[model samples]
Target: MMILSWRRRRGGHRTTKAAFSEENLSTNLAIPTHFLCPISLDLMKDPVTLPTGITYDRESIEKWIETGNQTCPVTNQVLKTFDQIPNHVIRRMIQDWCVENRARGVERIPTPRIPVAPRDVLEICSNIMTATQRGDHKKCMELVEKIKRWGRESERNKKCIVENGSGYVLSALFESFSSISIEEHKFLLGETLSLLIRMLPLGSEGQSNLGSASSLRCMAWFLKEKNLSSCQNAVLALKELLGLDEKHVNAFAEIEGVEEALVKIVKEQICPKSTKASLMVISHLISSSTSSENTISRFLELGLVSMVLEILVGSERGMTEKALSVLDTICNWEQGIVKARAHALTMPVLVKKILRVSILATDLSVSAILKLCKSQEGGGDQQVEALQLGGFHKLLVVLQVGCGEKTKEKATELLKLLNQHRGRLDCFDSSMDFKYLKRPSL
Candidate 1:
């Protein structure tokens, strides 16, 4: 046997033996080679033997398998099965060694919890359905808590839960409880939504169950909750559910306070993810042919135009694109155009973003500016503002740098519109580089 010795640092918190210096190991007592995991070279906390007759730490081997490899680490042979068997004898020896080396600063590893099995997840889902059918709120809540815990325990556990059909049961429960006032079952609803959020990319049946009007109302109610987690999950779930079908988009538009809640989420800037989800929801609603006009008016009344302009000023590339996309959709309506033109930041911000962001952003910016310029009330004024703010130069650059075909058309039309004002405005400078032009303060 090879003998190795290392001085353990006092009060050190390192987990792997490899972290220790080779110089420190020159004079320490020998540790059995079998005691260390082949993968990590650390003491095995939960030793298990593979089908290849190789024993390694359970976590290390499981991680190796999870990363898409199918071969035994040491044997370099194809694994017939990924099942791992607990090596109780090795675990006992390792524990005894730790006890014997307590004076050397070695700590004993505690036994690891058994991983959740598929049968365990199936039993929980069956019980949840039973409890839900019997009106046993207490039992249902308890089982839901267990499912939440297991889902959070590991990626494997979450996959097992989803594959075992927990999503159907949870969706049914959510739909059933949505008809009741939120205050009556706040905790139960909140927990169920949290779990459902984890099991996303829900199946068709699950999405159908959650896409009902009442369920959408429940999601809107959760969006108004004081708890940030509930708000985040609610909006995320709503976005997914709405995406299942176009009819759900129209239904969501009719939900009381749905528009308000989404707008408030965007305005408050709760978190970036929630904000993006809310924007997507809004986009769906506004794009729906059945409810486009009503949805646009409602969102405009909710002050969406100003909020999006504020976002465009400081947000990053992805978010800026979304905000502009929403803006462009809103500008499709005359009311949307009027509201956007009325805002102080509308012209300057739109002109500033013309060529600065991505090609998609340039497309949206040009489209929105074209709509604003077409506004009969302020058409000439917007054109003059575009001229003074170097809109003429930016439009020229858009044609040069390349943009979408439609954007190209809009750019050409906008160039003609701005050119009409170029001779009238004394501040128009064709020779000035757009980069050096001073943008108006927001």
Candidate 2:
């Protein structure tokens, strides 16, 4: 036993020396776990800002950013770029810096004071809102003319003095402007808060573009409502405002801050049975799947999927469909781990249900089948070909019968690959019709 033990120790020493040999591998070792985002601990995307308002796109890119006066996302102290993140032994122990998010800990910002209201407040507000609702440009222009008479009045009278009634009327008036002039769309996002006093969430009139409690709620409501007809340009405006495009000005306005805010809300309300707010936030993230692939991927890495699925398991079908659509988008990428995670999370019963249904244009069935084949053990020739065959058949049907041939050539090539490995095909299913799997011309 001693002789055997001595031999084992000597062999272990030899193996260690071999591993360290310069001829075997590069001395510059890759940081296995550190290749990911410090915040997400996943592959980096267009890195974003937290409440600390610090942003970076890449590590070296981050170094060039002036984060000196800026505070750290994990530590509140004023920051410089962290030079030794991967080298920090404590980072892995705490599960990346983002686990202690600085965004959530940001102090409540005071609402910015709004410009004083117009005198004859009720009259001007009613005229503007009425014209906005009717989509009557001449009438709205007429109201704008009348508004010149009231100048700036006391804050109390601005939106509160609607002559006949308040509350529900004002809400309806704002809601009615899902279609309105470009200027009116801009006015509503900020001004709606002043109009929404005595409501559930107070407006941050002085603070934000969608400042007040009421305005944020209204903004949240608009974003969450699935009906296209019930939406507004404010969403587009907000996002556009945040984006670097002057051309997209009108398209992404009110939703810019709202998107960032939604992420914060999702993290904040993480508890047993949070109200509808968290679910609404998840819906927005899923809705944004096609917004930008990198941004969507970043959102996923920030823990949106698992948290959403956990809390909103019995959510409406629309929500589930949106989530699945996002999964399809992520899975479309070659060798995306996010897709792998999504597939595991999608229950077996759900997969079966999807298969049993009469296939629709939007059905993700082919993608799912391809993914299944990729995951099978060995990832060897026969299994890979079978999966590609399933995808090819479905894609062909879609091109021939449903959609056009945008991806048909790619599908055809995949079919050709199946044939290349057809010799190895006998190792698997006899039902795989290799005779029909034609080789594509190079």
Candidate 3:
């Protein structure tokens, strides 16, 4: 055994390294237990020592803490503090071990960059403020790039950047640059928007700062950008801001081509997150606006109904819930209902989603089907289609499995409507078993 020791610290704490030799290394080329992170059981890279005297990889420990876990992973003891001290000695030992085992294909771990502290983030924010005040565009861009790098380094760094007030600073920069020519500041604007999106769930102050009409227009402009990330960020940012109040939602709806832009994003399927964000923004606009009828009409003109049904056919749970929600809101208007009922996939997709997604999704799906079946325009056809699509069985299953009072009411009403055509449709059998349908796990 190769004995290794270190001097004792003033607190009477001693640090020791694992002792290993060639004979032990050749046995299955085993890794020393101490070199492995307790959390991941992988060789430690950037090991950090917790107050519990247990060492873990920095990324693993930070993620554990960020997820609301306060207890040590190995010891199960409540952590007194979240501070993680770098275990330089262990990191060096791991590096040396990797180097000695290079012939055996062991790769060395690179040194980790020091994590940004709150003070470092605050200093960067200060520089951005000063640069903006001086109209030093070059200096501001440089600092923005540095901030972006820090934001991408780690979740902890991103949290530090956000907690240190980067949201307000970035919003101010975004608004200030909105006045410039698009060609002149397009890159900076995109970067600023990207950083802002990273600091989402912006506080009241940040939302207030970004809620201006000019800022809303700027965001709309980004929705038309050719860059996918910028477009996604723009819609996501709008979703967060508009959700804060009815006034913001109403204001955003008034922007020219806003509905068209959102419709295009959904139709093109820019990405799932962006598509969902756009759906949410549309839901807020139609559901919250004082002039909802006009807003719904505008969305219908932009082909919103068809795009939403296309999404519902293949979307996962969260996306399906959002799309169904938007469809339900849109169906409040006569034109919206007519457009939805006209689609071939609308009834089938709505029925397929029932009891398949979460309770919220089931509620939205049932609500949309209810609106389509009750509408005066082609309402009979919709009810007939529901009966043909096995919606009757799903509605029965919905009631048996239990749902919200409102959902239960909607399901009851829908079942009544579909039952009117039960004998006319061959899909419903008199001897069918209701006890065999799959129930959603509670």
In lDDT terms, which candidate is top? 1
Poorest 10 consecutive residues of model 1 by lDDT?
433-442
Q: Per-residue lDDT of 56-122 in model 1, one digit per residue for the tens? A: 9998998899899999999899998888899999999988987776556566677776678778988
Better by lDDT, candidate 3 or 1? 1
Cα lDDT tens digits, model 3, 345-400, are 89998998888988998898999999999988798999998888888878888887
Local accuracy of candidate 2 as per-residue lDDT tens digits, 1-442: 0111111123322344332343323222223343245544433333434434433323433443344435554546554544322222333322343233212221111222232333345555566667666666556445544333222443333333443343343444444453333234644433443344324232232223333333444555554444332232224323322232232222232344444444544445433222243343333444442445555555566665554445334544544444444444444444333444444444332333242333431354344334434544433433344533343344445445443243344345545544455445445464566555344444
TM-score of each: 0.86, 0.33, 0.76
Q: Write down the RMSD of candidate 3 (Cα, Å).
A: 8.1
Q: Find the 10 residues in a row with the least total lDDT in model 3.
A: 1-10
Candidate 1 wrong stretches, greater than 4 Å:
1-29, 67-71, 74-78, 427-442
lDDT of each: 0.84, 0.40, 0.82
Residue 110 accuracy (lDDT) in model 1: 74
Model 2: CA > 4 A from native: 1-126, 129-294, 305-320, 332-442
Sort the predicted structures by lDDT, highest score first. 1, 3, 2
